[model samples]
Target: MAEFDLIERYFTFEYDFTQASNGSANNKSSQKNKKPKVVKGIGDDCAIFEIPEKYQLVTSTDTLVDGVHFFSDLEPELIAHKALAANVSDLAAMGAKPLAFTLSISLPEVNQDWLKSFSEGLKNASKLFKVPLVGGDTTQGPLNINITAYGSVKKGRLLERNNAEVGDDIWVTGYLGEAAAALELYDKALVQKAALNHSEAELWKALTQPIPPLKFARKLTKLSRCGLDISDGLTADLGHILSKSQCGAKVCVESLPVSEALVNFVGLEQARQYALNGGDDYQLCFTASSKHRNKILNLAERCQINVTRIGKVQDEGLQLNLNGQPFESNRVSWQHFNQ
Candidate 1:
């Protein structure tokens, strides 16, 4: 299919953002939700959208390249899903509601089957996240997918990494290390050797189709002052928070939340390594005042997300403690250039 024909067939859709009911399947009960104003979408030279009153636009972009970001032979559908999900994860980190996104993909060759599957996955993710595809470009080149996502957050409620205060309790949403374990066990032949049982398939799913805690993040905007998604592992990503806030932290190694699947497959110590340095979990890590501990816990319960208090912000430098004893490590999170 030609470029325009491919877009018209697979990407084009009519969405009335003016209607509160126009959203993804996961948020059906959010019937009274408000949508941003969109004046023009795909088919135009540029998308024109109006930001809601008192809301600031939040935008983030991510790019995934074949062979580096993922195996070249991986499913096209999974590639599409991960490409968009990574960008949406940034929105979640910012405590923003997704509005729309643009996709720019480069292909080595036109394969109808691959294109069809990729487009379907993208569309499904769009509906699932309640974000519409606004506009994008398709080109002939090495396999590459870049997505720029847009979202909105109310003024003065935006979360930032620099806002963490000393003595604040650090929290993380959801279990970690599963995606890293999945990466370790991804080779089919190594799966059995890694002791990955049938029940642990969710780890693979977590690696492929990570769901950003958007609702939980939104709720956190009101309760927590500093936060970011754990895309680069807690050890390194939390370092970002510390550097920005000009503060230090003491992470309790035993407090790291390791999924049962991971612990069963790799044992506790290895799972801890993954949680600390393996990266790609995409869960949110934030800090709030100790006074709000109960409120944050209640919010987590209401949001149906598991929030764990892993540590506390401090005055000087990052340290890892295991059962009150200092732990030593030379590990760091994933760095695109180095990896």
Candidate 2:
């Protein structure tokens, strides 16, 4: 797509402030009154501010290295999107609304096209989440993108994984296994179908863009006991929650929500495994009281998002069960330092 088309199609719709930086005086004035304390700084700067009464700022950062977090040949814009989305996912895990972010990018060469596309994607994501780009750094090195996202939660409202209770219902937003299916297509021998059903373009889109669910964070904190984003597969990431919560869980394999694209690419059994153990999905997996069932359902319907009740918290330990038997949830992911 052309740069203008990309900005209009993807970035503009999600980002509220896309036109704010277009050298329009009215747009600049609109920005100034929104948050007065953010002091202006130069060179991709984010203005620092204090919210005196309502909220406390929550911050998180993530780093993506070439040949590790993503492929070198992938679109620069998508890399920027994914890098920012990953950090947004962290904020969502805390049930925080993103306010702004700063980016630090290191590159081996100065490619104008790459920078343009990357900035567009980052701007798009920031706008979509109502986050403004405050500041950043650029340097020459192997391709790496580091983003620090700032958000806020109403006094003491941030959710933590350690707050889960034994009887809480385990829920997850969106279907699983799409990202894993996209990864499988990277291998020619695997020859998986596209990411979405009945469209090669749609499949390619999912592979290129994974939407991070920031909208659900506030509602989730209200409805859930605890939660986390499903980055390192459901089984693996939930293990962190369960371990921290001092509890165990039973993931009903039969209840996992799998995409039609996944079922077409891999058979039922392996597809279930991918949804269970595959990584980088970036969806929210949470625990809520059974009493909040109606509230959660209403929230999902209002948001037009799918949330599956895959399992329940158990008092014993982390074990997944299907039919009448017990299974393991201690699957390992691609650890940064594997022995």
Candidate 3:
């Protein structure tokens, strides 16, 4: 598609540039103009604002490119949702409440239809998180969208991955292999025909719209020794936690949660592999003292998100215990070189 066609199709908005630029004129002419509560959000040089004291500002930024991160054929709305959700997941790992975000977009041209759908997706996500768009930049280029999200940490509690100690019980929120199963289904055109053991729609939705586990972060802060959001596959991201914590882990492949959708579609072993090595599932992988495991279970029940006891922290270097055997790899996670 042509540039304008693409933008119109993907990012439609009736932005009146004249009105946007003339905001200062209106402000100057107003007789009873109260001071602006915050700086220009959507209509200014930059998102101007002040954050109150007693709150730590948490920020995360991510970029998604058409050919590199996502396929052009995917829904524009889903594209927007995933882009925002992935960034929000970072804030979740830090135990922060999302506050706002800025977007930097580079597009070939304007496609109103695509813009409309994409903006709707962004709006939907913003409403879900109550995070407003403060400001951002737009320019001409191949399709790329970058979002920088901001959140606030309560006085002194923020989960960091470097705090895990030996004997901390490792846990992960939600099932592991469903997303990998969904990806396999997407790649093989194997979405379930019948409702057999699981919902095919759910798998597809999980693949498209990953939920950010920010809501559970507060409960996690109370119980976690250390935490990180799982994006770079279980083995790779967990390796991050281990390296930062100066510890090792023994992951029980049998103990990792696999959803019915994955079991039905991909059987057990392939599902296990996907669960172990699948990247892009934005679940939380955390370590806590053994003393907190029961309390953590109760918290998981209260939050209504699945909590799995996946592994334990050891006193040594990184190692894996899959199917009761040692599994070793110098390489972990998805690398651009492999692709």
TM-scores, all candidates, are 0.92, 0.83, 0.83
Model 1 lDDT, residue 296, Cα: 92
* lDDT scores in order: 0.85, 0.73, 0.75
Collision pairs in model 2:
14-128, 15-127, 15-128, 44-135, 45-134, 45-135, 46-134, 46-135, 195-203
RMSD of 3: 6.9
Worst 10 residues of 3 by lDDT: 13-22
Candidate 3 lDDT by residue in tens digits, 148-194: 99877765678898998888888888877566567645643333334
TM-score of 1: 0.92
Residue 316: error of model 2 in Å?
Answer: 2.9
lDDT of 2 at 253: 87
Q: What TM-score does candidate 3 reach?
A: 0.83
lDDT of 2 by residue, 1-339 (tens): 443343334333232333323233368554443431333432332455544355678899988988778886776778877888888888888888877777677778766687777778777766667677666666678988888888777766787899889899999888776676676555432244343346333334555577767787777777775888888788878989988998998888888988776777677677788788777888899898999999998998888888899999999566677665765443355457661
lDDT of 2: 0.73
The lowest-lDDT stretch of 10 consecutive residues in candidate 2 is 36-45
- For candidate 1, give the lDDT of residue 177: 85
